[model samples]
Target: MDHEKVNILLVDDQPAKLLAYEVILKDLGENLVIASSGREALEVLLKTEIAVILVDVCMPELDGFELAAMIREHPRFQKTAMIFISAIQVSDIDRLRGYEMGAVDYVPVPVVPEVLRAKIKVFAELYRKTRELERLNQELEDRVRARTAELENSTAKLRESEQRRSMAIAAGKMGSWDWDWITGDWMWDEGQYRILGVSPESFEVNPANVQALLHPDDVDQLRKAIAEFNSGTRSYETEFRIVRPDGEVRWCVGTAAATVDHSSRVVRVSGVTVDITERKRAEEQQNLLAREVDHRAKNALALAQSIVRLTRADEVKAYVNAVEGRINALARVHTILSLSSWQGAELSKLIDEELAPYSPSGQIRLAGPEVQLLPTTAQTLALALHELFTNSAKYGALSTRSGRLMIGWQVDDELLTLTWEETGGPLVRTPKSRGFGTRSLLASVESQLGGQAKFDWRAEGLLCRLEVPLTRKPAATAPSKFDAAAAAELQRASG
Candidate 1:
């Protein structure tokens, strides 16, 4: 609705006619431009934003129709309003032609100043209104684009927020629920369904169905917690077991707050449930480990006491050495079991520890497959091996640099058979009387460990064979001919 004066171009073949048209439009308060020919009018239009172009119908080469056709061909001027001014009266056909060529109206020659000014005024006003409508449309389009962009940005932010919320819920292993206690209506989130090991499509959601998933023993606990809430408790927490569809039981911890009526009747409950199965399992394992540690401690102390009571020595130094040596053997086995989390100790490692102090490298050769012995078996075997190693160092193969001792073991039919052979040592002879080392070794292998031990005092050196059950059970203690043949084969293999 701008009231600013718009440009009006007046074209004629004669300068006088152009001036006349200009004089007619001058009173309309518009900026009137004069062009003496059609070409001159096009030149004016190229340089100016003409609201109305008044062209001479008959001109030298490019007339009104030609100029209008050329102007309409240009994209910028396609909608421009044009009017044709003619000196002679034109035919209806010529007028139709002028209208088709983009002319808005026609002005006759020898025009009435009033008529010419009125026509120019109407067309110029129309041009101004059309420009205003185009400007308004452009502004509306800009606003729509800006609003669309803002809405897209807001939608993107909402989607991102939802993704982060879902991730947080999953990471915490938690799910939320809302229950209408009055109507028995319930709503569970995705996490709730997942924790219960059911899907919305597969499971009916109701109080009875949900209760069916609970462990029978824990159902009373859950009901008691709810009863407490109904009796004016603001909130309650409970842990229970869930029997999943796959027959696996899982632990869940839930905390809920209830809204009650004026009479303290429960109206609604809302809460979150978390999967605590792994945490509960870790706690159970820790308790079992504690109990096992206590048992092992008591047994080790009792065994140490027995060793101190049974150990005998004529001299105080010898008694101290014997007791210390036996206790040291127990301590070494204890350390190995502790390192393995009280599971077992490696057989090869246990033998190495017992003989490392007495046997030099290459003089003592140990040949055995890797074997893991139970804690009790490891402790017993460590004591027996310590006794044998001590006796050998004092009087047998380990006492001389040229002596060689070979220890080997094999597992067959769940029984471990080990052999110890000595060579290149002083001549051997049977003991006149049994020493504490020999007696302790025999008792440890035969009675406490439920195994058998055989000693052969050969002319060259002592050869010993021990048989123990891997199951930690007592095996037959009677000697067999197969044992004699195995011992002879071992001696031949050593030579």
Candidate 2:
């Protein structure tokens, strides 16, 4: 206990009594308030809490007896213990009066200061203990609240887990099983009975009954996978067909892993079986797509080759490299399309990625608003733009070291326009080829983009123009569409 913090009140009319009490309690290191009258003591009590009060019984106006009586009357001062102080001896009636006024002890004056100080010490220690108990109770309450919060979080997680289990069993068409070796008990998650087309009450889970539903042709592999499971030789994995009594055969992927006993023998197994008929159909479709894409890519290369052969000048390796480079650019676009399962490519992302080689230090400038096109629109535009860029590099404005290329686009109410202009090369000239690049570039862009094109061979440069319709039909807003942040980052990097 901090004795310095305890307050002692001395209510006496005599100045000498007040001084003596202060001197004794000063050595006890407690705060002391001396009240010269009963009224002063009541004022002191209202502002501060005193652990103990020493009252002088004999006084002129409102004496110690009256003060003690008033202290006992108020609920605010009920816990204060009063020890009566007096010089005169009291009669039986006065002693009875002191008891009625809440006096526990009396000290005859001149007061023994040590006795008074010792009595004050007892009450101060009790105050300290009471405060400690309150603090402990508050801490216990906080801990209980924290524990309750943790339990609520755990319960919510358990409910979410049960919900997830129920949803997967409902949606995934899976069957589950569990076995206990020691107790010889079997349990199945709800999905297990559903996939087997059996009710929970109807499922007889013995090994032989479970095997009855398997197709006859798959018996050997099923037996092998199960044998490995029972002997602990390997993890279980097998694909088998199940023929229902109605002659419907469904494919399933069965897998299990063993739990071992103390002797290192296989004691139990737990696993799931999933119906894979739909997945198998999807795989077949994927194989067909792969073959189709391969055929298309080869045909594109062959067509480019025919264009190069028909347009070639004798013994010029530069022309050959040019032909192959154009084909390779188209192939790169095809590769990106394949990653999307040939669904489509984003028009803007396709342009930026394909034009990167020509922009070396990103000296070429490009910016536009935005546009979206179907997969066919994307391929046609990619091939057409590739042809225009190749020609500019070889014979038009971009042929010289200081040449600059600027590409831009805009959209108005009913029209979209794209322009490609080059500067600082040798003066432009007409292309000699009526071959694939020239003919294909014109036809594809005009017909496919719902656009027209014009080529100008100027003295200083070459310029090409495009106009496409803006009233495009709505498309599904696939979330896999190009992320704008990533596109802007690429622009900043290239710029």
Candidate 3:
């Protein structure tokens, strides 16, 4: 707690001699530690900060020279001054040995208090100055660390700005150019060189050089836009085409702003160009798809109208039901084709939908490859399958608990051959007269699908075989959906 007191340690084996040393150093006005032996002195040194230590030459264990050597070995005591006292006459060799052991001076038994006080005062002052120097050095180091952190933060912010600018240019597919209108000098970034398919060394800096690569049709419009920009009438915004060095044509949209002098005269122009060829192509495709959808919708409506006309019933309800079923069949096929982007419909899927009412039944079995049918064939076949399923559910294989049906198909070149057989049901025979459903089924296969169908009546059941063309092209036919057989069949059914 006493900041002004410097610790001075005195070591002696005799209590009387320790008393004598203490009385002499009492006038120094410092904290004094007295140890009876060398061992006691080391214990005091561990707990206290000593400016100086005085030791006696004669002791029982660990005499003055040995204690001084131990103290000098400690890094904390590197600056501690030691003094040795002896009652006997000392030789030159003994004094040299004592000094080598870190003793500052050797005093005889007749001690002088003034000389000892002066030596202790010098070392005490040195310790105070050393502590102050350490405090100043620490303060300087703290300031340097704070300044370095500030510089690092500033550098990080600059790097972040550069990264964001680079990302913006890359994400927008944009290239920048700056031109001095008066000097006809232009500077472009690497992105600009890539956009034009030309290296910087091969590119001319003049505006006319750029105009030469403009598409023939877009040259006039681009020139007018540039003229307006130069006159300060309008800010530059235009879509044009450019032919690159590799002879590839690309669509480009550009925006520019003029840097004017104090007099409002345009001196420099800077702008960005973005490649828009993919966007333009996508728009064109979208428009074409829209027009195609419109045309297909119109044709579908016309076809439905013709189907309704061709479809006849005994009364209003029957007519509505028949038309509704037929249209639903057509719609199902349309859905299948639409899902595949009008590529085709899968044969297995078409059959599964028509036979959904009889699903999970052991009586019906369908097997075939995943053959794809053209849209027209799929539509015609969907209607035909609907009628066949209806007839079987009413009077054929699907009508009895034990009835069984099997349908399978195989592809041969451009023809898909399908077989339908019924078993475990009442014997089927040729009908007395063909019904509307039967006639429609036949007409759909033979005319609409450009296919052939034959029905055989046997004692076991009825067997139907069909061969359909797998061509993607639609079957050519007149607009009329009515045929002589369908008309006759409708008349008979109505009666």
Candidate 4:
């Protein structure tokens, strides 16, 4: 049988090294993923399943050994193969440490392409075989279970009374029941009693007793199904809920058939009941996830719409640039939130990413404690920061080579206070009137986030302060009608 391809991850800070590995592994016909740093490798591992990981031994932040240890810590990747690539001669102690950290093998510097390819191919094939074996084992187990069930059913049909009852005990979650209309008699096997959460000694096998165990809402449904069966229906299937003796409500599916005499009149009914509570719970969880995705998608579209409708510029190019910049900021926050499973995003990371374009100049500094912001808060704050950065780049501190910007924040009593101060720039003067950029920044913090924003036009540059509540409830997915009205008023004021 042909096996499906597996994934192989290559980690190195050097782009050249990653390219060389890619070239060597191309013939393996496996999915090859490259990460330029340990953090990037972790991110890839979060979203992809890898059979083999080839990591450089001397990368900064997180080396091969550290990465191996972290990967091994996760239950899903515990058995994944890790190979360390070292440029220099590794000491015996270093090799030992690597092995302890879950490294399966080591390739020295100036690797032979053929040797590297061979090693990766072996591991990739092994991973595929292992997965195939697991699948086959599961199939064999399923077939065995099906065969056993068939044999037990056949035995139940061939035998009567005591022998049939013995077979029902071995059917696990399934239980057998029989009812005779002529004698008004009902029979339940040991498994039936177990399913009802009762004992034969305490509970009698009678119609009224069984009806009492059925959930109130499902009683009418079961009655309707019985009525249909009595009207010449040979076999019928139905799902219902039963409230056990211990007050636990369990979902069950029953398959039943009618037995008739020569006159074509129903004489008896027999059926099997199986617990289906776990399946129902799983379906509920899936529905919840789908709703969450829908909610997030609507929120994203609404934010995009607001950006387009509210943005103002004099020239067409300037308008497109402004809209694209705001949209990109929204996209960046979305990426950050997705990486975290949409739970939230770190405040420091959001700021760093928004200001990354000017980071290389070494004039921007960020100081703050680790703070996580909700998705709505992060999205609005990202747009506000983008506007601030754009204005600074065009005419503020960032417009000059000698200028410096400091971003600092502190949290106290469930509130975060952040300050953005600029120095060493051209002389600053307060604007004669509010523009769209200023209005947008204020609206993002005040209207959308329910936060506070204060700006002071100092002689040196702009100094802004922001205060946000950390314990606020999540905002609505789309902006409210009031937000639109406010946007219109702001636009008129700016004009």
Best by lDDT: 4
Window of ten residues with lowest summed lDDT in model 2: 474-483
Note each model's CA RMSD in angstroms: 20.0, 13.2, 15.1, 24.3
Which candidate's TM-score is highest? 4
lDDT of 2 by residue, 1-495 (tens): 343377778888889778878888787777788898889999999899887888889877898888888888889787687888878987788888888888877777766778877887777667667767878999999999999999999999999999987776797568888876556678887787777776767667766766787888988886787577666674778888887655777888988877887878777778888888898889999999888776666545554544454334445786677677767766777777777766777666777866776753644678787675555456656777888777767676556677788888887876768888888778666654343455556655554455777877666687878876646531112211212322333344346
Predictions ranked by lDDT, top down? 4, 1, 3, 2
lDDT of 3 by residue, 280-366 (tens): 999999999999787767656755765687876789998898788778877887888899997778999999878886663788998
Better of 1 and 2 by TM-score: 1
TM-score of each: 0.58, 0.47, 0.60, 0.62
Pick by lDDT: 1 or 2, better one: 1
Model 2 score (lDDT): 0.72
Q: RMSD of model 1, in Å?
A: 20.0
RMSD of 2: 13.2
Q: Mind giving the per-residue lDDT tens digits that candidate 4 earns over 415-483?
A: 889999999888999988777878877876776677889999999899999998878863546476426
Misplaced by over 4 Å in model 2 are: 1-4, 58-62, 73-76, 137-175, 178-189, 195-263, 272-468, 471-495
What's the true lDDT of residue 221 in model 1?
Answer: 75
179-264 per-residue lDDT for model 1 (tens digits)? 99888889998899998989999898997898899988898977887778767888989888999989899999999999888987
